[model samples]
Target: MNEAWQQALSRVPELLAAHVQISVSALALAMLICLPLAIWAARSPRVAAVTLTIASLIQTIPGLALLALFYPLLLGVSALIGGGISAFGFLPALLALTLYALLPILRNAVTGLTGVDPAAQEAADGLGMTGSQKLYYVEAPLAAPTIMAGIRTAAVWTIGAATLSTTVGQPSLGDLIFAGLQTQNWTLVLAGCLFSAALAISVDLLLGLIERGIRERRRIWAWAGLAMIAAGLLVATLPLMIARDNIVVIGAKGFSEQYILARLIGSRLEEAGYAVRYRDGLGSAVVYQALSEGDVDVYVDYSGTIWTNQMQRSDNLPKAEMLEAIAQWSSHSHGVKMLGALGFENTYAFAVRPEDARAKSLRTLDDLARVSSDFNFGTDVEFLERPEWQMVRDAYPIRFKNARSFSPTFMYPALVSGEVDVISAFSSDGRIAANGLVVLADPKGAVPSYEAILLLAPARAGDQKFVAAINPLIDAITVDNMREANYMVDREGDKKTPRQAARWLNEKLRE
Candidate 1:
């Protein structure tokens, strides 16, 4: 077998663990939520119409957005009740997936409960059985098949949807996919996707067997469900119950810029007496949720990213205005706080190798667009989908006939090798100059600012010692300083160990 397959096989244990939690939790919760509602809906026409309609409507939402939507929503409710609600990671994914899991379960519950034979109901009633007793003893048994089928469907849906949970900072099979995708290793993505699918299929089949056995009056299915779920819960809770201490988890998006910032954060936190852990190479959508959920305590973020991606604000507000708006939004919406800026913006820049640019005379984006049809494009995953790309494309009308994408890792190499002539490089990336790449001028300001800033989880905001201890490092970081930091990992192959990078940065700052 190839090395990719070997790595994929190695992830079986992790994939299995994550799959069990996401599927079981979402299914169990979906059953709990839907069963009662389904029964109630079964009792009346309006109830069935409304509740089922709502559940179905929820199911229609694409998984990722549903997960994203619940982070802030549930966090808001938790905040109103108490001070310790973390909206990120497991909670949001769980809640959204639970909702998604409902349609199958609710529909099944309603069908099962109400589908009982009228003759049986009449006979039970004639025998002087009470409503609860008759329903429990008679209807529940008969409905078991339908109910289990619903659960089977719910389990399948949950397993499939769980892949998206990673976006909310919840770890699962998607970790493999994203990690691999960010590094341009298709083996990783295939491993994650295939494993997750296998998990879902296995679960669906197992549940189907149980449903059949229950329907067929075989006692083994009952024993199996108990065994499977019990085993799953034990495994799922084991990781959490592991001893944790004054551990601070820092996160970063998959790129050079995020690497430097995460390193800086980890370093500062350690110096101030925290045992730091790293959850580096997170996706943009996932990183914020991870922070809100308390999966990650802190990380470096951009004001414009918070403003646009998280808050859905489109205003080209000035730097101060944008930062203030994002800060307020985070506090009220996510129970998170923003530390001030790191004093430099790391915006997107389209660059080509100096040789390639010279040969093509592609100094400006407009000049490059004429030859765009001959070139391929490489950019961060988020940029490929953003409106900024559309705006830039419209302004310049650059039609790269052979457009392609690579993870930030491979982009530099591709550009240098003429595999892709134009790459969406970050301003703070050290690789641009290292590879003698020239950044094209975006005469039209389509892309927004991505100023580096420190974001604090609400739990940490009250600790003045914590805030004051690290606040000084932000302004101390300059563009050149950041570039050098990125170079250590990207070019120097410094293992991308942010903690080490951060300490080196701390010493530099101290000096």
Candidate 2:
């Protein structure tokens, strides 16, 4: 436990810096747009109503959904203009968070400006002051306190929402949170939450000081608050300013296997003298798109995922033919290189408790279908939406009494606790065996092959050193070794960090 906390703490500086950078940038951008708009809206009630309504509508959209929505929107725009815009990472996250911060700042600023004393405005007019002069000398100072209050609110909100940017591929404290949740590592989750909450609280306190300073007419207090914030931002940005070359950005989906593989890949790259960074917890579609766009240098993707999700193919082919077709399509269509399979499969398997399987005489999909109406199905959050699930439903007459979604980490526990009768388990997950669950046979072959495949970005496809560095991984990891590695991380007692598990797997490859 102490070691786990140490490992989790070691990562905090980099993640916290990234979290601060994005939060501050979004807040600053929100202020830039909102303050100007507020000045205009203060003069026109119609403008105020419309702008505020739009901001409110934006707020109504869930942060995660808003972040996810931008990927396709930006992709469409990029396609229309011949594809230069990146739909992943900082841009999408920035845009979503900026929009989120708008309402608080805009509403408060407008309220402050419009609510300025009428007598003061008259006095300025009587003094023959021009409109701009009145605003600059009189209205602005009086409105400063309220405007700062809005900024304080916006700062806290932006800091909180910025954590969601991890989904869009931006590195933030949320990476720790999301990865922890997936792996059930409470230490990591606690570390992420603690740092994020601390940063938000600190920023709010500083901004509150500025607000108070303005209200109390204390310039020293305001300057002191501003100085501290400047210092903090400088500290946060220093690491980013240092120039580093040949940095490889690895992308991974939200699961233990993906995390382990990413670290394994990173370890190999680092041995080859490349600086490494990871973008974990990417969605299935988003990770592939990111690689194709060169936002990610390399990552592992399943052959079946590329086939059904990317190729839009419904028909099943032999494993070799499917891999060949996927490779050809990826190289030709998107310039992505299908490096090779990792000699293992993590296909979705319908697993039930061994006792239940025996009691129901369920050994296959056909058997499961016979008793489906009495069972409750549990799946990873994405499985129900995946093409594989739809294909299974089409192939089988199975219809569960109820279905629920959970994080991959919780699905096995749900099965063990009898909260769920069955789950869409990964064939390579160790917990399936650990819990002695039985995976129903798919005699119909409706589910496509899901051999784990490494993919390279277009730019790296021709790089011999890059290719050679990763080539050893092809056909290296057996399913047994992978399950062992995953179990090392996923197991409740004496859990290994993904990096440690990767190291253990790498040693197995050597043997």
Candidate 3:
């Protein structure tokens, strides 16, 4: 627990900078976007009704779903624009958060502006003031407190929700929370929650001071509030502004194991004197594309994933031959270099709770095939769509009574808790042993070998020093070692951060 806090605290500066950058930027933009519409709507009730309705509709979309939806939508835009936009990271996160921040600000702005005293406006008109002048000098000043209240509410909401940015490759305090949740480290989660709450409370107080100053005509409080806001913004954005140019950007897919491996590789690179950074939570296809396009310098990917998903090959080559083919195909096709396998296979395997498997005598896919309709099948969202699943089904003629897809995080618990009777389990996942699940054998070789292979971008292919730094890890992490490292993070009540687990793996390798 102390170690988890140490790890979480160490990342505070970086994560806090990212969190503020996203939240502040989103709130600022949302204010800019919504305020004008709101002011205009204040003049036109019909327009206000329509615009408010739209903003309310946007707020109804679940936060995580909104963030996920941006990826495919931006990917399409990038395709149309000949590929300049990134589908992940700050852009999508900022855009999604900005949309979420809109309704409150817009609603309050409309209410504040419309609620302004009509007699005040008449007095301003009597002074021969133009419509814009009356709005600026009379209505705006009178309505400042109410509008500022909305902005305050928005600032707090944006800061709290900004934590979700981690899901789309944007780093934030949520990174700690997500890592903690995945690893089951309550200390880390608590730290993130506590810190984020503090930030919200602090910002709300400061903004409240500013609002009170405006309402009461207190110049001292107004100036002090403004100064604090400026100082905060400067502190928040400074780290991002002075970013290093030579950092090696590593990529990882959206999962706990991927997060651990990326951190492990990144820590190793850092020790080797390379400046390292991670662009994690990438979609599988995006990571590969990012690697090929030089957006990412390195990442670990499975040989079978490349062979089938990327290479579009269906033939079941022998393990050695498959690795060779994957290496050759990647190098020739995408300018990707296969460094070497990491000595473990995390292939897709059918798993059932031990008691259920024993009761059914489900020792192999063949056994499951005979009574396929007796159980419900569960799998990660992507598995059912993958070619490997099609191959498995064709080979075994197995079909469960029902099949449901879940996020990787939920799939195992779903299977173990009897929500589903069988699951497509990652063969090397630590959870299999932790939960005491039995993996059914695939004697017919339906699933291909899934060597955890290291890959390099084309430009780095000839950098032997860089290659050598990572090459020693090839074939160093045995299945047991990998599983144990993963378990160190996944096991309940004794979890380690990814870096801690990675460091343990390094120590084992040295021994």
Candidate 4:
């Protein structure tokens, strides 16, 4: 196997532990709540109808949407309660997964309880059993098989949906999948998928065996299956129990470059004798929010992203001026410290294949304007919604044949394949040079320079060691180094895992 695949496999134990914890925790919590509610509902027709309807309603919300919605919901609750609950990570993921798990378990439990034989209840009552005794001795055993089936179904659903937690800053197998998909690394994606599938299948089979055992009045299979689950939970949560202090949390946005940078930062912190954990693949806005809220310790963000998106500025300032403005604004407004630029700019640039640029004799935005009608434009999803694009459009008389948005991962492939004639590309992206694309110059200076900058969370701003430790990296990474690191992971034939790429970059930085 290749180094990339080997790296991918190395992560399975850690990722699987996370995935299992998330899945089992959510399923276990759901069962605890749903089973009792199911019992109560089985005894009362009105309660059963109301509870089932609510659970079914929760199930109808798309899993991703449900997960995203929890951020603001908990944010508000946190404020109202004077701050305790975290709006991101395990809490929200758990809540969303538990909600998703509820319908299946609740419905199945209700079905099982309600379907209990009337004759059996009468027989239990004739034997001098009270209501609770009848339920324990007669109804529960009769209902065990069906209830277990519901739990099995819910377990599968919980495990599958738990992967989405990666988007909300909780690490799981989905980290591998999301990072892989972004970098077009299928090995990581496939590994994550296979691991998650195998886990679900294994859990389902064990639960199925337990269900069959209960129905046949065989205690051994049921006890053995339950023991396996308990052991897995213990194994999954052991890391969390041991590592509880002196850890730095690093955040990264969803892309190859961010992943590489996060790993670089993590390795540096680890080498400094600090335990480092990452919350990778956070949304651009979400990462900043997490940092400011102290949910994450540090991350790299571009100047222009903070300038226009976070700061809401529209002026096209020079790089130094913009960087200074962002530093001051962030410090004053959000208590976040913009340590310094990373000595590289990853700005928005319009790029075309070299062949297309040469055929059109295009060298600048002005040249593009003359032939704009012939080319279709492509951009990552945020560009169209960003003020930078509006500035560029208003500055030039350029009108493309069509414009479409793609995820960052797909944007370059789309451009290279002729799906789009021009792409609003990130200047530092490795694929731009790797694929031989020419970025058009903007003589009019319509776009802002996106110099990569390091940001510190409010809680860590005063930590002298933390700040000092990261200072060396501020001006260390150049555009060339970044692009090369990105290309190592993103290029089709030559692949390096993010950690390996980070190690390579660290070697260069030391020199």
Candidate maximizing lDDT: 2
C-alpha RMSD by candidate, in order: 6.1, 1.3, 2.8, 2.5
Candidate 2: residue 198 lDDT (0-100): 95
For candidate 2, give the lDDT: 0.92
Over all chains combined, what TM-score does candidate 2 have?
0.98
The better candidate by TM-score, 2 or 4, is: 2
Q: Across residues 127-227, which tens digit of lDDT does each residue of candidate 1 receive?
A: 99997898788888899899999888888878888887776667688866766655445666788888888877767777777888889998887778667
* lDDT rank order: 2, 4, 3, 1
Question: Which wins on lDDT, candidate 1 or candidate 3?
Answer: 3
Per-candidate Cα lDDT values, in order, are 0.76, 0.92, 0.86, 0.88
Q: Which number leads on TM-score?
A: 2
lDDT string for model 3 (5-54, tens) is 77778778778888998998899999999989988999999999999999
Error of 2 at 27 (Å): 1.2
Question: What TM-score do all the candidates reach, one by one?
Answer: 0.70, 0.98, 0.90, 0.92
- Give the per-residue lDDT digits (tens) of candidate 2, residues 1-511: 5888998898888888889888888888999999999999998999999999999999999999999999899999999999899999898998999999999999999999999999999999999999899999988899999999988888888888888899989999999999998888899999999999999999999988888888999999999999999999999777777786778999999899999999999999999988999998998889999999898999999989999999999999999999999999999999999999999998999999999988999999999999999999999877887888889999999999999998787889999999999999999999988899999999999999999999999999999998999999999999999999999999999899999999999998832
- For candidate 4, write residues 1-511 as lDDT tens digits: 8776797898787778888888888998999999989989999999999999999999899999999999889889999999888887889899999999999899989999999999988889899998889889888889999999999999999999999999888889998888889878888899999999998888898898899889898999899988987787788667667756878999998888888999998988887888888777898867887888888999999998998889888888988898889999999988999889888899898999999888889999999999989989998877888898889988999988999999877889999999999999989889999889999999999998889999999988998888877788878887899899989988878678788888898877732
The parts of candidate 4 lying over 4 Å away from their true place are: 124-133, 366-373, 397-399
Cα displacement (Å) at residue 135, model 2: 0.9
Model 3 C-alpha RMSD vs. true structure (Å) is 2.8
Task: Give the TM-score (vs. native) of candidate 3.
Answer: 0.90
